[model samples]
Each structure stands twice: as structure tokens, then as C-alpha cells.
Target: MNANLKGAAMMVAAMAGFAVEDMLLKSAARDVPVGLILMIFGALGTVWFAALAKSRGDRLLNRDLLHPVVGAKSLAEIVGRLFFVLALALAPLSTVSALLQATPLVVVAGAALFFGERVGWRRWSAIAIGFAGVLIVLRPGVDLGWGSVAALLGMLGFALRDLATRGAPKSLSNMVLGVYGFLALVPAGAIMLAVTGGAGVPPAAALGLIATASVVGTGAYYALTSAMRLGEVAVVTPFRYTRLVFALILAALVFGERPDLLTLLGSAVIVGSGVYTLLRSRRETQTAAAQEI
Candidate 1:
């Protein structure tokens, strides 16, 4: 199969796995502490990735993983995972997922600022409008609260994580990055657990849920990395939107959430703007390539 198609399929599967992971964690939140859930997920993911790396004869802990840029990436990951998990526990899953669609827009702005990438006025305008869409979803001054703010913070954290990933040394394999990403979660979970102590021996069911989420989340990470590496990024990246579809379905079926019209409109705007930004960036790359040719 062609690379784009392969990547698209991988992206879809990866998103499905992620959706399942979120659903499982959300369900377990009823009986398990969010911090404990994160702790278990992080520990299991670290072990999974570490073992996979070792099997390939890669170092379990590379000094390069602690490089400044990677350290920043780890910090972003901690923030992103911690807030996103908390948002899941406290907010509507579909709404939180929709808000996360703004990450690409945030990433675009972040790149221009931190990475010295030149973004044209048009893209900047789009980013502005995209954030406006986020505000619409948030409905500040009307339905505004900590949950909405937490979701936005989670989006920005994820945006920072992605932006930092751009500066990661190419010598480090995806497996190595994966291991470190999960490893950072160890400290993140501990900090959260310290603040929100609900620690106890989890029941068998909670343990099972945690194990299932860890395995599925680990697989999703691998699949996402594979998809990005294997296909044209523009093709694969758009498929990330499928996560919203999966999330909305799960929310409706599992949580009985029927998003209001404004929420749906806001989601549409976020997706449209993000896709436009990515496609425009891809066009710029192509134009630059042709000039080089």
C-alpha cells in the first residue's frame, strides 16, 4: 500500500486505541484516584517501552534523553498528561477532546515563536480565529469554570510537548523517546498523588482497568510514531481528527453526553482551522522543496 494510506490506517487505529484508553481511565476514575490511575499507567507504560527498547538492544536510559530539549519535552509531557487526565476526570470527555483539537493551532504559534519558523499573516489570523473558536467552546463568563481552563491548559501543554519534540535529537529512536515520555509520568503521577491522596490497594477490577489502559496506550504511542514516520505527515496528521469521532461516540454511549449545538460548531471550527494550518504548512514545504530542486 502507499505510504499515505498506510499512515492513515495507522492513525485511525492509533486514535481508536487512545479513545479506549481514555474511556477506560475515565471509568476507573469513579473508583480509583486520578493520580493512582496516572501512576499505574505511567509505570506500566515505562516498563512496556523499556522492555521493547531492550529487546532491540537499545539503551534503557540514554544520557541524550536528558538533554535540555528533551528535558523540556518531558516537562511538557508531564503537564499535558497530568492536566488532560484531570480534565477527563472532571470534564466532559467529548468537550475535552474537542478542545484538544486546538493543539495544532497552538503548535503553529509556538513554532513561530520558539523555533524561528516564519508564519505568514494568514496563518496567524487563522490561529487567532482558531483560539476564538476555543473561547466559544469555553463560553467564558457564561459557563466558564476550572474544567474549561484545565482543558485549555492541557491543550497548551500538549502543544509545548509537540513543539519540543521538534528539537529532540534525531539520534534517539522513537522507542527511546517513548521510554522517556512514560518515565516522566512517574514523577508527574507522584506529585499529583501527593497532592490528591486517595492511595489504597486497588481492587481487582481497578487493577484490570489500569493494565488495559496501559497496554492500549502503549500500543497507541507506537502506532502514532509509526504512522508519522511512515507516511507523508500532512496525510497522517489530518487523521488525528478521527480521535474526536471516536471520543464523541464513546462519550455518547458510555457517558450519555449529547453535545450542544455551540459545542459542535466550536469543534467544527477547531478542526477546520487546524486542518487548514497543516495543509498550508505542507504547501509551503512543497514550494520550498521545488525551489530547492
Candidate 2:
């Protein structure tokens, strides 16, 4: 298969994996505390990534994990995963997933502010429109509840993680970064569990669900990493939006939750703006490269 096709396939598979993980975690959340779910989920992920790192002859504990950029990345990872999982447990899967799609827009805006990237007025307008889509979904005057807040926080954390990752040192392998990312989840989960009156005993069925979430979530991470590495950025990046499709399907079939028209409209706007931003960024890069040549 062509690399682009393979990458698109991988990206789709990753989105599917993540959708399954969310479904499982949401199921488990019926009985287990969100924090305990995260603890087990993170533990499994940490072990999985650590083993992979060892297989590649990478050191498990390295100074790279402590680098300022890496530290910021790890912190963002914890916040992202922790709150996202919480949102899954508390919010309608479809709504939270729809809101989560705004991460790339957040990243674009953050890059412009923090990295001094030159975002043209049009892309800035897209970002503004994308955020307006988010507001439409959120409906500020209405009491949308904590789930919306959690989802928004999760998006911000993820955007921060992506931005920091862009500046991370090349010396750290993806596997090493994965290990640190999962490792941060452990303490975050632990703290959450403590504040939530300790971890309650989960039913055996919930334990099974948590285990499934862990495996599928880890697979999603690796699949996403592979997609970005293998495919052209523009070709592969749009596939990330497909997660919303998979999420909506699972939400309807598994949870019997149907999103309203407004949510659908909001999601379409966010996706449209995000894709435009990516294509425009890619065009600018190509133009710059041509001039340099």
C-alpha cells in the first residue's frame, strides 16, 4: 500500500480504537470512580509503553524526561487525559467528543501566540469562527453543566501538549515520550482518587471494561503516532476528525444518545475551520520551501 493510504488507514483505526476506549471507560464509569479508572488505565499504558521502550533498547529513566519542554508536555498530557476521561465519564460521549474536535484550532491559535508563527488574517478569522462554533455548542447563557467545562479544559490541555511537543528535543524517542506521558497519568489519577474519597471497589464487570479501555487506548496512541510519522501531514491530519464520526456512532448504538442539530452544526463548523487551517499552513510551508530552493 502507498504510505499515504496506510497512514490514512492507521489514522482511521486509531480513531476507532479511541472510540472503543471511550465507550469502555464510560461503561466502567457506571461503577468505578473516574480517578480509579484513570489509575488502572494509566498503569496499563505505562507498562505497555515501558516494555516497548525496553524492547527498543531505550532507557526507561532518562534525563530527556526532565527537559523543560518534555516536562511541559508531560504535564499537559496528564491534564488532557485526566480531564478528558472525566468528561467521558460525566458527559454524553457525543457531545464531549464533538467539543474535543476543537483541539487543532486551539493548537493553531496557541502556536501563533507562543511560537510567533505567522498566521494570516484569514486563518485567524477561521480560528475565531471555530471558537464561535465551540460557543454555540456550549451555549453560554444556559447551564450546560460541568461536563462542558471538563471537555473544554481537556481540549486546552491537549492543545498545550501538542504545542510543547512541537518544541520537544529530537533526542527523545516517541516511545520514551509515551512512557512519560503515561507515567504522569498515574500521579494525577492518584490525586484525583484521594480527593474523591478514595477508590471504591469496582464490580468485576467494570474491571473488565477498564482493562479493555486500557488496551484499546494504548493501541490508539501507537496508531496515531504511526500515522503522523508515515503520512504527509495534510493527508493524514484530516483523518483525525473521523474520531467524531466513530464517536457519534458508538454513542448512538452503545449509549442511545442522539445529538441535537445544533451540536452537529457546531461540529461541522469546527471541522471545516480546522481543515482549512491545516491546508493553509501546509500551503505556506510549501511556498516558503519553493522560495528557499
Candidate 3:
């Protein structure tokens, strides 16, 4: 397969990892502090990503992960992961997944600001309507709650994380970047553990399941970044909706959580809008490439 297709495949795998990780975290949240669970995920991320780097022949001996730009990107990711975990912990998986559907919009805005990328009227329109879909999912003022707030903040934070990762040096692989991201979280996790009266060990079975989730997540980060880079950000992003399908199914199976009609309808709108944006972006990228040729 071509490199780009390989990247998309990796990204799809990453999304699957993300789905499983979210499920595990949501479940573990019931028995453990949110802080502790996230911290554990970070720890797992650090070790697994570092190993991936070494195995891939990416050196891990850099004084820093290649300047402040990469460092900033990794740190942003740490913050994003923390917020995402808390969001999932406190809210329904379907809702958090749906809220995260807003990510493509965030990416478009970030590209315009950071990379001097241009946004045509078409993309801008899709973004606006896509956010409207988010509002539909949120229906914020009507059903105001902490989970909504957490999901919103988490969405924004992850957006930043994604943006920062874009400018990282080509020398560093995703594995290296992921390693630093998790390492950045270590101190933060330790601090939280202290604040939470030390880690409260949950059932061994739960802990094991969570550990597996963390491992998949560590690998998934690389897949996701690869996907974003391989395809047009706008185009490849709609594939993220696949997570919602997994989440909804798991939510029903694991939690017996049934979403109401409004939720499903809103999610459909949000996802459909996102898919349109992705297709447009992909077409645009192709047109741009053809022009260059």
C-alpha cells in the first residue's frame, strides 16, 4: 500500500484504540479517582511509546524532544489526555464521543491560525454547521451539568494538542512524541495521587483491563497522527465518527445505557456534517496537489 493509505489504516486503528480506552476509563472511573486512572494511563503511555520509538530506531536520547515546539506539542497532549479522561469519567461515552466530533472544526481553525493555511467558504460553512450540531448534542443550557462542561473543555484541550502536534519536527517519530507526552504527565499524575490520598487500588480485574486500554491508547496516538498527516485533515477526520459507533454499541452493551431520540438525531446531524467537511477537504487537497503537478 502507499504510505498515505498506510497512515489512514494506522489512524483507523488508533480510533479503535481510542474507543476501547475510553470505555475502560469510563468503567474504571466508577471504582477509582479520575486523577489516578488518568495518571495510570499516562504512565502506560510513556513506557509503551518510548519502547515503540526505540524499536523503530528513533533515538530517545535527545536532550529535549527537539526544541520547545515539540515539547509544547507533547505537553498539550498531556493536558488533552487528562481532560479527556475526566470527561469520559464523568459523562456518557456516547456524549463524550459526540462532543469530540467537534474536533475537525477545531482543526480547521487551528490550521488557519498556525500554519497560514487558507480556509475556503465551503470549509468555513461546514465548520459553522458542524458546531451547530455540537450545540444540538449539548443542548447545553437546557440540560446544564458538569459532564457537559468537562466534555467541552476536554474537546478544546484536545484540539490544541492536535494542533501543536502538527508542527513537530520531521526527525521525531510519533512514538517519541507520545513518549514525551506521557512523561510530561508523570509529575502531574504524582501530584494528583498525593492530593487524592494516594492511589486507591481498584479490583485487580479492573486494573488489568485498564492497563490493556492504556497500551492500546499508546499505540493509537501514532496511528491517529499518521492518519491526520497522510490524508487531508478535514477529509480524514470524519473517520473519527467510527468511534461513536463503537461507543454507542459498547455503552449499550456494557452500561445498558440507552440514548434518547434527541441524542441520536443530534449525533447523526453532527456526524453527517463532519463527513461532508472531510470529503470537501480531501477533494480540496487533491485539487491543490494537482495544481502543483
For model 2, how does the per-residue alpha-carbon lDDT over 217-264 read when each residue is reduced to its tens digit? 878988998999899998998999999999999999999999998889
Tell me the whole-model lDDT of each prediction, alpha carbons only. 0.87, 0.88, 0.78
RMSD of each: 1.4, 1.3, 2.7
- Which of 1 and 3 is the better model by lDDT? 1
Clashing pairs in 2: none
TM-score of each: 0.95, 0.96, 0.88
Highest-scoring model, lDDT? 2
What RMSD value applies to candidate 1?
A: 1.4
Candidate 1 C-alpha lDDT tens digits along 71-182: 8988898888888888888889988999999999999999999989989887888888888889889999998778778888888899998888889988777677778887
Global CA lDDT of candidate 1, please?
0.87
lDDT tens string, model 3, 157-177? Answer: 778877877787777776787
Once fitted onto the true fold, the runs of candidate 2 whose alpha carbons sit more than 4 angstroms away are none
lDDT, model 1, position 92:
91
Output the lDDT of residue 6, model 2.
Answer: 94
Which residue ranges in model 1 land beyond 4 Å of their true spot? none
